[model samples]
Target: MTFRIAILGASGYTGAELVRLIATHPQMEIAALSADRKAGMEMAAVFPFLRHLDLPKLVKIDEVDFSRIDLCFCALPHATSQEVIAKLPRDLKIVDLSADFRLRDPAEYQKWYGQPHAAVELQKEAVYGLTEFYRDEIRKGRLIAGTGCNAATGQYALRPLIAAGVIDLDDIVIDLKAGVSGAGRSLKENLLHAELSGGTHSYSAGGKHRHLGEFDQEFSKLAGREVRVQFTPHLLPMNRGILATVYVKGDPAAVHRALEAAYAQETFLQVLPFGALPSTRDVAGSNYCHIGVTGDRIPGRAVVIAVLDNLTKGSSGQALQNANLTLGIEETTGLMLAPLFP
Candidate 1:
């Protein structure tokens, strides 16, 4: 049976991406599209790349008939996401791509987002949307919180090592470089072509990046103790991917093997040969994550490099993956497209 889907915040990048993917999905149909500011406008006007497909006109959230939608993908911004989702049909299946429900603890939400979560109860009920790690929970979940692109990339590199106890837990570092698209489509003076075209710089440094909260929460939960990782995110001049270079104290061979074994059966995760590395361009515009491992000159040290399209595997693609599970469909449906390469 084809599931009817609604995409809120349809005018944004992630929302447009959802349209692109779902347009080809045989088991899902875009029943409604909502874009508060651009209500009544055609999605083709906002994203001409999608002009080939016929999509519903964009409307406001309240204008949508949630009762008719089988599943809804919430792509609205954080603070607003909770307010909107709180009023959505509680029984409706939701795959939220915002930061609103990622953190289970309201205290941690407030600490990182600088505000109290408006939907505390839903926050607690929303399952983490790391597809491979939480597949079972997601299938049974009513709401799934999509993880941060950076957080997801880092976890793809380190989660297996952490679980296998092959890496030094206390000495982990994630140095990530992300394409500008990860910042969202909102206009910022710094994101202008004149300002960012030929340069790059780290924005959230010194433990100031909000996604660290996810790292702390998830890693700590995995280790059954407090696991704080040193994470720094850099904004690159490019437009569509994230490459996380994770440093860990472990045997490189063992780290590679752990990741290989963990992701051996995972459709989207590809662990490369030892000493091999992945490039963002290799996974651009695709729902795949390519990871590589190499040993450092120093003994007991390893470097794990993980790459993915921030817009695809990092966000929209990940959202769709969870939606499939929630609807009891094959997890890889409409998501096995090969990455774009120059």
Candidate 2:
């Protein structure tokens, strides 16, 4: 019972990542690959690391035979995904890796993305794809929206604490550092080696980052109020990973207990022992999120740190995890690879 899968926007970072993971999957086959600009080119030309495996040649989205694909991973960019997905077959299961359908409210989407959602009805049907938190919904959904890399890292650190009522929701703060790959494969002046290699700088400060929409939506829903966390993202001089340092007002011991208990049974999420901290290098290239908790020098405060590969666990891996559930397969299938280390 192999599942035939189609990957739209196959030339991008996340798209290439999906191909890398699915190539070795026991029950999944890459039947089609779509990259409008790269159509007719072999994937190896775009991502040589994937050259070892035999795969379908890239094609345009309209050229893909959707009727043969059991599932489609839409790795297209934000605004572009809505237009493409709206025209796809309604019954085909989809895991969208873009920001298109992540926000349930179209008005919220417009507020953050600067435009009204083109597929409001589809947005209504899409389930938020935080695999551990929304397992049941993802298992029954036809469309699942993957969270932002930064959003996923922060939530893995705070969701449990918020759910247990162990933290002060009013004073939450998140400082995240992300690798260059999270920006995608597009060329940018700041991403050049001469500009990015030597130092780090913050962008989207002052509550302007688009992922704040996700934080507001998910956190508020959990606490049953409008919980807004102060967030600032920094660009690190690396190629892959995200490290989020979260500050919360709570009993440090209780924060550790809540996190350990919540992720005790999760296969891909690891909660380190209290007082221990996590590093992005520890979880690089794997579908695993490592979280550590420690008490602040000031009483009644705690710092929760989480790290994961921005390309793997943050986006493509999360998408595949949800796809497994949507197809009624084992959730850990094709996603148990260990982190790469020197």
Candidate 3:
């Protein structure tokens, strides 16, 4: 069966990506596209790269007939996503690519997002959308919340180590370098070519990044205790990818072993040979996350480097993965495309 799909926030980066992937999906069809500000415009006008495919014109959220959509991918922004999703048909399957339903605790959601969750019940019911870790839950979930690109990168590096008790819980550090696309397509003076093209800088540092909340929540849950990691995100001059260099107190070989074993069966996650590393360019525009491990100069310390295209594996691609599971389709459908390489 061709599952009918609706993509809200269709004018944005993630939304456009979903359209690109689903355009070739054998089991999914784009039934509707919504872009409140860009309503009535052709998606081809918004993203010329997609002009080759015929897609529905962009409409407003209220204009979509959710009753006909088998699954909806909510690529809208933070608070707005929850507000829109709250009014969506509760029976409709949803894969939210925003920060709205990621945190289960409404209090934590407020603490990180600076507002009480408008859809607390739905938040409680949404499954975390890390396909590798939450496959079973996603397969049965009505709503699946996609992870922050930064958070997903760090987790891909460290989750297995933590689960295997091979890493130091108290002294973890995630130094991430991401392209401007991860900030979304919104116009920012800092993101302009003149301002960002020649340099690199850190935005949310000193535990101020919102994804830290996700790291704290997920890591703590795995370790059965409070696990806080120092996370600093830097914006690179490039366009699309995230490279997270995670430092942990552990044996490099053991950390490598744990990750290899955990991801051995995962289709999109690749752990490289020991002492090797991954580059963002290797995984650009693809749904694959390449991770590498090596020991630091300090004997007990290990460095885990993970990379993926923030727009693909990080957001839109991850959203599609969850949607497939929720719809009882193959988890990797339309997502096994090879990474773009120069």
Candidate 4:
């Protein structure tokens, strides 16, 4: 039973990635593709790499026939997704790959995103799409909100530690580095080859990064208190992947055991051996997050490093995983492909 799917914002990096992964899926088919700017153009025209496969021509969101779409992956930009999703059929199962619905609190959403949510009712009903932590909720919900790529990476490293009470809640710090592609395919002065390549710089420093809203919301909920981690995101010259170097004070062995126990059954998350670190290159182009733990040279502290392709495990792949559950398919279905290697 193949489910018919529609991908909104199909001309973006994550949207093309969804097309790439679903091309090989056994129980999913792309019935519609929407990219407002690229409407009337073939997907191959926007992404030449996808030319080998036959796909629907890009169209406007309203052009899609919702009655024929079993599920919709909304990969549109943050502020735009809420408005677009609000008008979709109420019965349609949606997996939003934007920040619009991630935070449950309307006040928090406005605080971080700089605008009040247009669809408050939908925002309240949207389930957080961290598949590993919210699998049950996701399986039974009609709307799922994908976490930020950086937020997802950092959570993979710290969630278990927080749950196990193995780390100091107030002292956590997350220093993340992300590939250029995570910024989206939009034109930016800083993302040019001359400006981006051969150089790395940090942005959203000093706890100003928006993903901190997620860390605060999720980590606080997990610890039963307000837990804020100092988060700083750096832009790497590469095209994909995210590496979050997390600093925490805890028993290294206990942290390792907590993560191992938490994700032992998870198919997409891997915990490397202690003292061994992870690299973004290893998990590139796949729905896999590799985590490593090591004690800091200074006693009573540990370093947790997590790496994954921001475009894959961090966004589209995560959306697809939640969509499978919403459609009553196997959670891992269509997502078993191994990490891509050079």
List candidate 3 segments past 4 Å from native: none
By lDDT, the better pick of 2 and 3 is: 2
How well is each residue in 31-84 modelled by candidate 1, as lDDT tens digits?
A: 999997789999889899999998999999999999999999999998999999
Off by over 4 Å in 1: none
The ten-residue window of minimal lDDT in model 3 covers 115-124
**Runs of candidate 4 exceeding 4 Å displacement:** none
lDDT of 3: 0.93
Model 4 per-residue lDDT tens digits across residues 218-261: 99999998888899999999999999999999999999999999
lDDT of each: 0.94, 0.96, 0.93, 0.93
Of candidate 1, the 10-residue stretch with the lowest lDDT total is 115-124
lDDT at residue 340 of model 3 (Cα atoms): 80
Which is the leading candidate under lDDT? 2
> In each prediction, how many residue pairs overlap at the backbone (N, C-alpha, C within less than 3 A)?
0, 0, 0, 0
Q: Give candidate 4's error at residue 324 in angstroms.
A: 0.6
